[model samples]
Target: MRKFWQKNRKTSLAFLVAALLIAILWFFFWPLNRVVEAPGEAVNIQPMVKIQGKQPLKQNEFMITAVSIAPARPVSYVHRLFDPHIDIQKTNDVTGGQNNADFNNVQKVYMQSAINNAITVGFQHANRPVTKQYHGVYILNVFPQSDFKNRLRPADLIESINGQQLTKSTEYVNYIKSLPKNAPLKIMFKRDGRQMMVSGHKHDIVKGFNGIGITMIDDMTIKTDPKAHIDPGQIGGPSGGLMFALQVYSQLTQQRYQLKKIAGTGTITSDGQVGEIGGVDKKIIAAHKSGAQVFFCPYVKPTKTNLALEPGHQTNYQVAKATAKKYAPGMKVVPVTSFDQALNYLKTHQ
Candidate 1:
């Protein structure tokens, strides 16, 4: 064995080095069935939201926080092992069994809904006229077995079915239910601002009901008096809802954000409620890094019933507070269950 080692030592060393390089490459480049969610940037909301014919309020800054999500490599797991704020989620779970493109499409739809809700809430609070403008039903997901699976996409807008106009998701559902099983469907839809048409047959989405194998929601917009333009640009998610609403309200009411740099993440409903969002811990880290003085997090008062539903659960505010304590001790985290609560905090705390 010693003689053999002496004779083949150089070749053995070369082979070992090659193997090590391969393992490093695999760890670096190979994709996993997971994704890493980490701290993203805190974007200023002023420039992103513009209220026409209204003077923009000269406040410090109301910012929206984001969470960076990426497909996990083996090296990402190593990073997660070191970073407590980073989380690993299954790709299927994150995308809801859809491809990345479909996932992004759904996110864009959510963002649009958030913007509409924000406008409605802000206008109502400001005593401004705001009316709902329904365009059609938005396609959220397309099943693989559907006849239009290859032709339709998640972000497409279904304007009509069988020459009948569609203004709401319920209208689409009811119209589909009126048709026979496997009935031919002539769908008029819009994609990327261009009108398109597709011919397909309905499938049994439910056990007995026959319909297009697609999940959808109403495509509606809030037309506010004096107009408010919100261009989310590449930021696609409902997380910006609260901050957007805040910005809108601040401008309309001429009330400034008391804090120098305020950052937050929460979904805003049409009723002016601030709903809980994902990645509160990472959002706190991002807000702190952006020099934000305060961060508003969605909080739900834990009750016996809620606690019983989940064995061990912490609210977003709780997670944000803990994350701030450990990583961003200087930043202040405020718990708010609704838009009024958040506005009240800014009013009283300052």
Candidate 2:
């Protein structure tokens, strides 16, 4: 028995080493199903995006704010569980598709979002008549387990869904909302500049509701003023839309004034509507820290809030207002549903 034990010692040692390596990989290196988010710093937009060609009048700096979010690993997720400010979300929830976390692809989408917001806001706020020429809808991210999984790519353009051409994101959403459950849907998309067609079963997304699981936005050309350019450097996302428009308007129309330094976040369209954005609480803290005198946040009624919960749930104005009081007592957090409202407030206040 002693001779047998000695003979197998090396084998047992090898097995133990292998098991340890597996445990270490699982604990530290393997990807988990969750991600962590903490309060990000508020970034000033005045210098990040540059407006070229035709410099209007001069005024005090009007800044925009962004929350600094960092993705966490599984080990960090456990630590975040005890942190009140840190948020945990599924990896799929944040990335959508299996490969959505490809830093380059994500950066492309973010830059595109920022560009769209900058252009649309610039044209609209400049009081220039803007025309939207829609080509298709740009696929931002395909949700995990989606029917289009393994078929559609991130940059694919969905030209039409179910034989209906899409010009706006609202149209695609409304059309999907009107579809019958379990119906087969046809999607015509352009990949690598080539058109392709595919059919898929719909997904029962969110409490028995049937629709395609994808995140996308309209691909439209905003033709109004080509001379106005907004360079957002590497910063991405649509959250800076409102602030971009405000700053662009100040430059385009030459409405130079010594207005108080302002900070805002929202998705702005070519029609002058200010859509809601995420991270209002963190953004308010950022704005206050940046010494912004006014913060323009989106306003959505309770009814609207309930409808777009997944896109975003919290009422930005309410959260921003509350956060401002706690973090920045002297700052004014204003609610705005449209650019008109913000402009009016600026007129009155400035």
Candidate 3:
């Protein structure tokens, strides 16, 4: 009987050991279905652009930062859920497909578009002529929560709003903004090879962005400027448009002007309009880490997450404003709706 009892005890111990080993392997090696986003490094934008027949002012450093996201292991995903600074989304929601290379190529294409628009807008702000033609505003993206998500899509050309001719993006924006909240807008657009009219009421897509919820660029021509040139090597995306325009504007207008180190992110339209961007939370942290004295953020639009997540005044500026206070109390966060507003702020504040 004693021998039999000892044998049973050893058998139970072996089973426990095998179970422990299996649990350990699963804990560290299992793949997750989500992607995580966190702060990415910040970079200076002044060095990115090269002007022809002119030396850009070296007085200030203009920078833009990005957020990095990646697929997570089971353990990492579970851990990130509790981290306030880390953001997560379903892989499908973020990547859309398994082909990362294709997505990167798309980003490069968008970056080139940003550079083109920035060059035109920056030169225009400097009062340098580069033939501005009003063809129609181009939609770059349509978020799922936007009121226009069902009616409009990316690459759609905006021809008119409420029977009024749409020239610049600002015209369309002002017309919609002039109405009360959730007002219906009559929009004329061309998609694919056909012209279509869509009527939709703008909702609180974001708390402050009560108009159409589409990211846009101009569909007009921007003849390259003779006096200045921009060469942004390897770096890709529309977020740097605002800073690129500022760099060009500051260099051309001011002679021997010293600038305080400022960083920002936004898109620039051909007419010197500033548009909103993603990753405002991560960017604020990166700019502060890079020792930026002041950070300029877009005040153009807002998101449903920003509106619902943040109760009051939800815009890119509001996110940057809150981020600056929380992460870098020493850094000043300023918001701008146009290139001139950003320029004037720098001139007066310093």
The CA lDDT of each predicted structure is: 0.86, 0.71, 0.75
Clashing pairs in 3: none
- Which ten-residue region of model 1 has the weakest summed lDDT? 303-312
TM-score of 1: 0.83
What's the C-alpha lDDT at position 4 in model 2?
Answer: 90
lDDT, model 1, position 84? 82
RMSD to the true structure for each prediction, in A, is: 3.7, 5.9, 7.8
Better of 1 and 2 by lDDT: 1
Residue-level lDDT of model 2, residues 1-350, one tens digit each, is: 98899879978999999999988777766665666666565555555444556554446566766655455555776666675456677766665535544534555665566556666666666657656677777777776557987687776888888899978778888898788787789999987789999999887766766778888877766556545455666566677777777776766666655455777888776567888877787777777777778888998886764656734455777777777777689988899988778778887875
Please tell me which model should have the higher TM-score, number 1 or number 2.
1
Best by lDDT: 1
TM-score, cand. 2 vs. native: 0.71
* TM-scores, all models, native as reference: 0.83, 0.71, 0.65
> Could you tell me which 10 consecutive residues in candidate 3 have the lowest summed lDDT?
97-106
Runs in model 3 deviating more than 4 A are 1-30, 78-83, 96-102, 131-222, 227-234, 254-259, 300-313
Residue-level lDDT tens digits of model 1 in 170-201: 87888888888889999999988999999989
For model 3, what is the error of residue 132's alpha carbon versus the real structure, in angstroms, after optimal superposition? 6.7
